[model samples]
Target: MECARKDRDLEAEQALWQRWQARRDAQTRAELFDFYAAWSRVLAGHYHARYPHPLAEYADFVGLASMGLLQAIDGFNPALGSRFKSYAEPFIKGAVLKGLACYIKDHQQTSRERLLSVAGEAEEGDDLATIVNLTVGLAFGYFLELGILDAELYDNDPASLYERENGLETLAYLVEQLTEGERRVITGHYYQQLSFVQLSEMMGVSKARVSQLHGQGLQKLRRLYEQVS
Candidate 1:
């Protein structure tokens, strides 16, 4: 009779533990996302330090790390007796490497074409409309090739504090700091998340021309960021 009573108590304890474990798991998952949200900039800094690129673009790495963090949370096994960081470090590193591979693949193919175009047209006057059109088309085509639907790209607009704070005032300040076209392209592209194709079409320019404008805009923004720092 005593053994039976003890068995019942143990079962109750086990059930309570199971419930607590589930709750803890959920809390941990949320914490993991928050951790990644904070760590993304740090991860990007590590990447930038290791690799040379025209810009310190970190969006792709952030996206990849978020995926890794999600995977780590889902696959975490307390029973396995492995540390979370041990499992996650490799996963996050792999994600960053994959992002870098994609960046390299895109660059190798496009760089030569862009260089040739620039060399051929170095003396030619700017054709703003043509440039914008070409950029929009190319951006659209690249996104399509990557199986990213137009609807998916355009569907979401995540709110940020920066965006919330008087966009025009921010833009005016950016313009004061950046050149005319630099301000326009940055405003049109990154802030608004408009694809190159969309900007090109709206501006009545070719896709290639829009790329040049975007590149120039990025350069000016980079300089402005440096100056402020």
Candidate 2:
């Protein structure tokens, strides 16, 4: 009985594919997607479970997987004698990874912008200190993000994958030198993409205090760099 049900489901799927190929209409395309949508969700859930990102919600992954499923339905050649599930799995997984890569890139950009904002808020007559803090903050932020970076989290672009091999080591050393409060602020903001407000709430402090810690962290990193150089 189980085998019979499986055969029936397969036949229905094949019929839908044929109808889609014949008319190439939106209705048929959507029907095909509906048939495979559950499988796409399964793939999305699988990948999300395997590589959870702090910045990405599970729904984000599901949406990306849906896009991949649509592509698979549009491009699949049934005559090739391959199962649709097998063909679509790679497409779905690829989409999820690609989406994650974009998310990480956006987070990194936000981190830079926040660093710049913090630098701009520095008190007058601290021009030199602000510049140094901004430079070190940006550098360390990038490295911290890179340290947790995965190749699969990168778009399949080779240039995007290019990273300094020593970045992780440098980031670790600098981070180690930070005071406990500074470490919490810097790591929470850069590594987890937390906002100053979020870090403040987590640490039970004022947002201003969190920002101050972040700036002090960057200054310490700069001083450490100067000492090493």
Candidate 3:
């Protein structure tokens, strides 16, 4: 029964991809974004937390992520045999990062042009609850990637306070501070609840390698986790 259900879901997703690829029509493209757009928010929230803009709202991150989603829709190629999410994740993330980098640069340049000085203000506290699983990998420079099952690429502290809570209702967030390979192993082992041997097989690498990542990921999680959390 489960296998049949999985098959049906796959078929539905494939059909959606086919529709988008067929004509690249705007309406079809819109439909695609409607389905996968939440991932943009999930992925972008991580960026917002990492790169806080004193004046920017959470919605600003969503807008950037939305742009990435649109870009992914345009760049996704169905012929690759990978799931649409697999192909789109990187493009979506890349676009968001590029947008964020531009935002930071513009802000920095504008600040440089300003001759006026303002007093330093105390940082504000976050009220929203954030549910996330953080593991810093490849981007941090010390994890193993077996070329398969990679979920990312790589979050912060008081904001870390909100992240300590547990519940599906909290609206999980995504961050890519780690490399794509490292994120995959951590997600597979921890979030997916896979065993080291299982993850090793899935990733086409030795179990020892998986073990190393699990340890390193845990250390990073501790280092990056909220101190009071």
Candidate 4:
């Protein structure tokens, strides 16, 4: 019942948006504002929590994010056959970040290159960022040539499976098939750059147990890859 009600609300909202889009209605602007205002605040909070500038307030971030949300709404076309939420969320968040960047540029007198360098360093070891682009996911993308992951995987398109290899999504799905200990062992070893000894220490298990987990994970990954291929 709740799901049906939510769906009805969404249909109504989209219908209203379509009308606003046609006539450029002022009330439609207000409706968009009311709908996304709280979301803007939440996204702004994420920036505020991690941003380097101490003087940057939550309200300021919210204002910046809200502009991004508005831009998304203005540019959106229903004919694209894409979900508005999916397309708009990234656009809004990107706008907020860009706005913050501009503010930083004006206030700090710092170069954009320096800010990018610092941000890069902060996200260097994060797994989600590491595996973000499928192109990079194959050969470990950006981490390639650094000996972080095997180089052969880079030979294929990370986005599409031309060679019938397991790719990133398949690997993740396979990991879901693993026992928790096995998953941790593999993630720590490859993704987190932890040695077997380190994993053993962290998990409060023997080195042999860690080795067993690693073996299990590898086996599962191999099977999954073979099945996909």
The sequence of per-residue lDDT tens digits that candidate 3 reaches over residues 184-213 is: 555544333244555555456776676666
Q: RMSD in Å for candidate 3, one decimal?
A: 18.5
| Candidate 1 C-alpha lDDT tens digits along 4-26 | 99898567545543453577554
Q: Write the per-residue lDDT of candidate 4 for residues 129-162, one digit (tens) a residue.
A: 5435322223331221123222235555655444
TM-score of each: 0.34, 0.45, 0.41, 0.42
Question: Which pairs in model 4 have colliding backbones?
Answer: 136-141
Estimate candidate 3's alpha-carbon lDDT, on a 0 to 1 scale.
0.51
lDDT, residue 72, model 1: 61
Largest TM-score belongs to which candidate? 2
Poorest stretch of ten by lDDT in candidate 1 = 143-152
| Error at 184, model 4, angstroms | 50
Residue 44 miss distance in model 1 (angstroms):
3.0
> Which tens-of-lDDT digit does each residue in 60-152 have in candidate 2?
676678777777887899989998899988888887888798774245535644675456545567768667866766775565555633213
Backbone Cα, N, C clashes tallied per candidate = 19, 0, 11, 1
Tell me how far the alpha carbon of residue 158 in candidate 2 is from the true structure, in angstroms, after superposition: 52
